[model samples]
Target: MANIKSAKKRIKVTLVRTERNKAIRSKVKTAIKKVESAVAASDKQLAQANLKNAVVEITKAASKGVYHKNNASRKVARLSKAVDSINA
Candidate 1:
C-alpha cells in the first residue's frame, strides 16, 4: 500500500525488475545444469557446447548485475575445467 504516487510507481518498477532478475537467474541455473549434465554423461562435444552456452548466459547475467563479475568468472572457469578434464 503506497500512499504516494511516486511510491506506487517505485513499487511497480521493483516488481518488474524482480521478475526480470528471476528470469535471468533461472536461465543461469538452467545453463549450468545443462553443462553439468553433459559432463556427467561424459560427452565432450556436448559438454563443450553447453559450456559455451553457459558461459554466455553467466557473463550476460554478470554484466547485467545479476551476478558479480568474479562470481561469473569462477563459474565459467569451473565449467571450462570440467570440460577440459573430459578431454584429458
Candidate 2:
C-alpha cells in the first residue's frame, strides 16, 4: 500500500498503463498469429492480406512505445519473408 497521496496515484496510473499495454500486446500477438497461420496453410492471398494487417499492428505498437522500433521491424521483415516464400 502506498502511504503518500502521490504514491497512491502513481500506483493507480501504473495499473492502468499495465492493462492498456497488455491489451495492445495481445492484439499484436493475435495479428502475428493470423499471419503465421495463413503462411503455414500456404494461402498466398490470405497471407499477404494478414501480413499487411500485422505490419500495421506492429508499427502501431512500436509507435505507442509497446515495442521497440527494431523489434517491430524484425517482426515485419520476418512476416514479409514468409509471404514472399509463398509467392516463390
Candidate 3:
C-alpha cells in the first residue's frame, strides 16, 4: 500500500530482487545437494564432477551477493570434505 511514487518503485524493485535472489539460492542449494548425493553414493567420478559444479555455483552466488564470501567458502569447504571422504 505505498501511496508515494518513490516508495512504490522501491517496493517493486525489492520484490524483483528478492525473487531473483531466491532463484539463485535455490539453484545453489540444489547443486550442493546433487554433490552430496553423489558423494553418498560413493561414485568418485560423479562426486568429483558434481563437487566442481557445486563449487562453481557457490562461488557465483557469493559473487552475486546471495551469500557472504566466507559463508560461501565454508559451504564449499564442507561439500568438498564430504566428497573427499567418499571411497571410489
Candidate 4:
C-alpha cells in the first residue's frame, strides 16, 4: 500500500492504465482471430472485412501505445497476407 497521497494516486492511475491496455490488447487479439478464422474457412469476403477491422483495432492500439507502430504494421501485414492467400 502507498503511504503518501501522491503515491496512492499514482497506484490508482497505474491500475486504470493497466486495465485499459489489457482491454485494447484483448480487442486486437479478437480482431486478429476473427480474420484468421475467416482465412481458415476460405471466406474471402469475410476475411477482407475482418482484415479492415483488425487493422483498425491494431492501429488504435498502436496509437494508444499499447503496441509499437512497427509491431502494429507487422500484424496488419501478416493478416493481410493470410487474407490474400484465401484469394489465391
Per-model TM-score, in order, reads 0.95, 0.97, 0.95, 0.96
For model 2, which pairs clash?
Answer: none
Candidate 2 C-alpha lDDT tens digits along 36-61? 99999999999999999999999999
- Model 1 deviation from native, Cα RMSD in Å: 0.9
lDDT against the true structure, each candidate:
0.95, 0.94, 0.91, 0.96
Residue 12, candidate 1: how far off, in angstroms? 0.4
Tell me the tens digit of each residue's lDDT in model 3 across 1-88: 9899999999999999999999999999999989888877788889889889889989999999999999999999998888878862
Q: Which ranges in model 3 have alpha carbons more than 4 Å from their true place?
A: none
52 in model 3: Cα distance from truth in Å? Answer: 0.8
Question: Per-residue lDDT tens digits of candidate 4, residues 1-88?
Answer: 8799999999999999999999999999999999999999999999999999999999999999999999999999999989988858
Off by over 4 Å in 1: none
As a TM-score, model 2 comes out at 0.97
Question: Where does candidate 2 have its weakest 10-residue lDDT segment?
Answer: 79-88
Looking at model 3, the pairs that clash are none
* lDDT of model 1, residue 75: 93
